[model samples]
Target: MNHSRAILTLAWREILRFLRQRNRVIGAVGQPVLFWLLFGAGLESTFRLGESGQSFRDYYFPGSFMLILLFTAIFTSISIIEDRKEGFLQSVLVSPVPRWGIVLGKVLGGTTLALLQGLLFLSFLFFTEMRPGLFEIGQLIFLAGIAAFGMTSLGFVLAWRLDSTQGFHAIMNLLLMPMWLLSGAFFPIPSLENGSFLLHWIMRCNPMSYAVSGVRQQMDGSFLTADLAADYWFPSLSLCWAVTILFSLLMFSWAWKTSSRRVQGDLR
Candidate 1:
């Protein structure tokens, strides 16, 4: 098969598999809404948005959207483990397709699912009192797609090496969950009085921090506000986009490398 055809075939299969699973749809789209309603409402009064006087729910809108993308990416990538066990992956490995095509197909499949769910979550913004202009809506779509691509690629890399879905879950909870929490999705980077310099450094190092920050910047156009932008400790919007794109490329390369190594080892 040609490279493009191989990629499309794999991606189409993933999309069909995802659509056939009703529970996956509910879990991907429903849980994020539940979390937003429950946690966001609970914290709205207690957690203020700096001096802007915005409620936590308004501030958390972007994060919740990111959560949808993250969850979808996680579940979609986990299918790799199942495919491996069922010998489907081995069949693909032995096919005439390039390893990069396989990686692109899988990553793009997960990314497509993530972006779809993330956009669905966007419809809830009206209830949250957020009405983005046409330009802002476009920006949200662009940023959401980029974030989903990078995150799904990251999950692909992890799932590519794993043998079990349970193991993927454990590692995801340990890695992805904390990455979200620290990405300023749930809370602002803590003040020095309430947090440590090390914690601040860690947040800066997290690539997802830029993803979250990029989404926030797109949604609110907060980059125009100098003081407000500085308060949150997120990178600049351009920086966020650059870092996120770099991250996506790096993760895609890593997954391709890992898959190539696996194919070589199997031949040996």
Candidate 2:
């Protein structure tokens, strides 16, 4: 089998599957934009007084965009579970393509979906906010690309062992909510006076925190004007991206190896 050709074919199939379900694409991209347009604007009065003092629209717009990417990653993983349930995954496993290639294609396909949705969200944001220049637009797109890959990688890891869509949804909800909340996407971590030392520490350690901070800094107004060091923000997000990708590789490799071993054992 031509490995690259098989991967391209599989990835194309996945993209077409997503595209055919036009509602999924629309809902995936539209919800976040609607949230930022309605709820974020309504909350603008509240978030404006926080450390960054950004209008809620500006503050939530990027985070809202992040949520769109996040949801797309999680939702796309559901397709994997659905395939497994329908024996589609087993069929793919019997194909001539290498297991690693199959995994890579799925990850890339999902990342592409997430990035497309992010672009749509960012377009809305750009139209609504007048101050962001070409550089800021570029920066946001760059950040969104990194984040979609990171989140898709993470989702691919979580989907590796799941056999049912319900199981995937259960696990995703368990993992996703805390990650969103502790990440400081909604509001900046104020100070120890507001929480216990451990809670504060967890927020500091949350990878989503790094993603949000990197994105927030690139907004029309820097989310906070305290003059965050570029060194700090850039490295933190890079680390988050690295960590997400590393975990994904580890997970995919494990799944591929385990499945291959199972096949070999069955042959015996």
Candidate 3:
């Protein structure tokens, strides 16, 4: 098979599989929306930015959006585990398709789903006062695609080594959930100024932090604007963009490297 055609076939299969799984759709999309309503409502009263007059809901909008991408990626990555358990992956592994194509096929599928769902949630901006022109929204959506690629690759790396979805869920709970929390998504980085130096630096170093900040910067006009009145806590947009791209690249490199290995390659 043509390499590009094979890759797209694998990717399309992933999309069809996800669409057939109705529970996954509801769980992936609904969980984040619930989090937004519950967290946003409960915290909006207590959380306020300086004179920007930003509520926690507005500040958290991008984070919630990111969560939608994260959840979709998680759901999609589980396909690796499922394929292995069902012996589908072993058949693919024996085929002539390049290992890198398998990696890209899987990651690209998840990235496509994540980007689409993230963009759908981005439409929620209409409900809010965010006044971004088409170009700006396009830029944010592009950033989201990059972030989704990185995150799905991260899941691929994790799932490639495991045969059990439970194990994958445990690790994601231990790693990815905290990753989002510290990504400056749950709260402002400025709030950590007087807090733990270790934690402050952790968030500063987290690539997801840069991703969330980039979204906020893009949406700055109305929601979580980077006006001078607010503390300068986020990394510069240039830096965020750089880190976001680098994060996706690094995670993908790791995913590809791991896929080249044979140990624990499948449940059989």
TM-score of each: 0.93, 0.81, 0.94
Candidate 2 Cα errors over 4 Å, as ranges: 49-52, 127-130, 191-195, 227-268
How are the candidates ranked when ordered by TM-score, highest leading? 3, 1, 2
| Residue 212 lDDT in candidate 2 | 69
CA-lDDT, candidates in order: 0.83, 0.68, 0.86
Better of 2 and 3 by TM-score: 3
For this target, which candidate reaches the highest TM-score against the unseen true structure?
3
Q: What lDDT tens digits, residue by residue, belong to model 2 across residues 1-268?
A: 5688777776677789998999988778877878878977688676563454457677676678778888897788777766766667777878887877877777678878888888777767655443667886677677666666667767766676666678777887798867876676765554555556776677777767766666665655444444333212223445644654454455556645544543221222
Angstrom error at residue 79, model 1 = 1.0
RMSD of each: 2.3, 4.1, 2.0
lDDT of 1 by residue, 33-91 (tens): 99999988898779876556667888888889999999998899998888888778888
Residue lDDT tens for model 3, 1-268: 5799889998999899988987887888788878887888898899877767777777788999999999899779999999988889999998999999999999999999988788778877776556778787888889988999999999999998887899999999999999999998888775354567787788888899999989888887444454532454668788989999999999999999999888565536
lDDT at position 134, candidate 2: 80
Per lDDT, the best of the predicted structures is 3
